[model samples]
Target: MSEAASIAEMPPRYDPNGVEERWYLKWEQDGRFKPDLESEAEPFVITIPPPNVTGELHLGHALTYGIEDILGRYTRMRGFNTLILPGTDHAGIATQNVVEKQLAKEGVSRYDLGREAFVERAWLWKEKYAENIRQQFRALGCAFDWSRERFTMDPQYVDAVLEFFIRLFEEGKIYRGWRVINWCPRCQSAISDIEVDDREREDSLYYLRYPLKDGSGDIVVATVRPETILGDVAVAVNPRDDRFRDLVGKTAILPLLGRELSIVADEMVDTEFGTGAVKITPAHDFADFEVAERHHLDMPIAIGPDARITEVGGPYEGQTVSEARVSVLRDLGAGGYL
Candidate 1:
């Protein structure tokens, strides 16, 4: 309708669509793509990297599957019993996110539907999109065995997955442990490191005045994220820096939260950076988390999964990150610690 050239008709002074319609579909339907199991021809098998049933296939899918299709065609022509096995992955988080967004538009959430009902909606979503994806594979005129197409959540595939996990468990290969992870506040889920997108932005650095428990004049440290001060376990200075060398063993009181923060000297601290000292909020910042581990200090969480200030933040508890930042700065300014 938009006058975009159909891929089938995209060729030099000729139409591949006619050839494709008369041959590719019949060649595929006649089982020309499927390798003969009984034949002694040298087997050339390649299992597809399953695509998620999220939506229509994109250019990424075209690039990958196109290469495989070429290889499959070449092998079959060379008298090899080529088997290009095709399948779809559940792609768990991505699929759930799609369904949740749909439910959101209807003024409901997965919680309202409950686990069983939510899963039902997910299946319905999968069934709809998975069929479209399968059809797209055929529309591309690839020599794939549609009859043998599999879904990751199919009973047989599920059984195979469970068996593999059970074997790993029996060998004591999997265990639970405390560690830092990337959490999506919007999704309320933990995602892999690959899912996080890093961005560069300019920000103002705030100089926070931390009071000494001994009633001595305050020591100042600089930070870009003043909100995480509620979780501060320690303040670190460069061990080689002469400025705060004497104050290394002293205790500094966190301004708003009143948490006792030990002043520690570490080589990781950048002496040339702001104020030659940095606050260590282990639960909120990765660098601070590492510093805490080296000092054998407790890692108290300042924020919850919803990116809201937790109970440990005291007066700022339940406030969103932005809201808490304003409140924390306001209180800090009132107390003359900003």
Candidate 2:
């Protein structure tokens, strides 16, 4: 029998421990993983979804790399010039938080280290964690071109990002404005919606009475967050709701702040929910922020980035959200507004 036929008929014995590394190293040394750009062969190119340089790889990384490696190897065997590029992401806030925790261990903050020193420290942290990820990829037998490895924070990448942003700004595609954003108090940065994790949690709902300015009567508005009452700028109700139809053009007195709040009719209010009335605290709540913008209402920020009540919170200023909730509820109950 031919040698190839004999090898094909051999018993199947899976032993990756010694075999994988040896074959992978040989493949690298033989330059089989490198693709010739000028070649006429069908090209199969893939760039890894760069893993964060903030930490070591986990089970998720293993699974992802395994699937991609299978594709790369399959394409190479099919006579395609496969090029799999490997890279690591700076992960911005994630990497910053990791370095910040390290700094905290030594009783120092990033601000204390200064910008230049902090950047230097962050790069060192990236280098350390990046190598760990590279090894994990190799263990998974990923046939990536290590010579083409890249980092999101590299000088070329940084320049490209800057150019993109500058082009957008010049074209009027980018502009700064006061907008509601998902903020992380710990990271002290704004994060995108996808970064937020949604989970079920038990919470308290508070109902407060807002007295009408014309002495007609009071409207009860229910809220899960009473601490935000300090930022109340308007009281909204569905225009189609008969209960609040007559009070649309009137004004209401904000319970705690004693500020005059217009009783506005906005379609955004759900007539079937919570007494059909909602207090609009534009700066704190996203829905309220949109309603306030539509009606041209003022936005008062009662909470700061630290999750503490701000100066606009009146007597509750400087108190954390939880603490202020207790104080606000206590005062509301005493004043017969609860």
Candidate 3:
């Protein structure tokens, strides 16, 4: 018989669509994906990339498992022993977000549920989703060693991560504090720079006044956010600005918010931007953050993580930041202080 005819007569080498479920269950129950130290055959292994726990099957997953399966199955076909390791990132932020969303639907917050309860919910969610993922991988016929599955957030795995972080800190490579972190509102966490993609577009600029402490007149200042006015801590100008040289030692009455602030000269101020003066809300903008740090100005965050005006924002408290901005501007303009 011809080779092609012989193969065709060989019952199709067992159709996966027909036997995949039964064989996969049998293989998993038999621990086919487990390591065999007794095997002396040349070992080949390939680890798959970890995807987010909430992730659905995408082109990336397809391509990744496809290539890895090719290598693993090819090596086994060549008579070498093979193992394909599979895993995923615990991805704290993404997992936490999923839990938080569930909590939100029931009108409860994570803080109310406590860490343990929230975590339990997350594990339940993880278990349900992980099974789906395993099925998807099986459907692809990837030969991964399922018994040795590693989760990045598993207790054993977390110990390694904690140990690494401790070692890195000891080596002076890692530390923590508040800074200009790119925070994700949905995730309620600070994401690394690698996670951020900036797109520059047109943004409006607002000109307003920070009146002198004596109520004489006002220092005209420019800002992109009129809403940040409630958070203003200082009005800054170049130290050498001829028009405001005498105003260096003075104070400015913060409009609407009534937060008294100083008129200070900072070298970082650009002489060419908006009346050569800027209103500094240390809690809001990056430049103001640096200016506050250098000037030892009190920097209290006036906007909460929810991006609402915080309690320290006085009358604007509890309002969405954008709404607070409009209200503050109208109040200021109505009072003839705009």
Measured by lDDT, the strongest candidate is 2
Model 2, runs deviating above 4 Å: 1-13, 40-44, 70-82, 99-122, 191-199
Q: Residues 1-338, candidate 2, lDDT per residue (tens digit)?
A: 99999999876998787789888899888887899888899999999999999899999988898899899989999999999999999888878988999999999998999999999999999989999998888888889999898898789878989999999999999998789989998778998786788899898778899999989899899999998899999999998899988889899999878999998999999998789999999998889999999999999789999999999988889999999999999999999999
Worst lDDT run of 10 residues, candidate 2, spans 186-195
Model 1 pairs in collision: none
For each candidate, C-alpha RMSD in Å? 6.0, 4.1, 5.9
* TM-scores for every predicted model: 0.78, 0.82, 0.65
Q: What is candidate 1's TM-score against the reference?
A: 0.78
lDDT by residue (233-262, candidate 3, tens digit) is: 888999988989988879988877678898
What are the clashing pairs of model 2?
Answer: none
Model 2, TM vs. native: 0.82
Summing lDDT over every window of 10 consecutive residues in candidate 3, give the lowest-scoring window.
Answer: 177-186
Give me the candidate number with maximum TM-score. 2
Candidate 1: tens digits of C-alpha lDDT, residues 1-338: 34575755667576766776678778877899888989999999889999888778999999999999999999999999998989888888888988999999999999999999999999999999988888788878778887788899899989998999999989999866556789998778888775678899999899999999999878899998989898889999998999898898999999977889999988889988999999998888888888988998888888999999899899899999999899989998999999
Model 3 sits at a Cα RMSD from the real structure of 5.9
Local distance difference test values of all predictions, in order:
0.88, 0.91, 0.82
Model 3, residue 253: what's the lDDT?
87
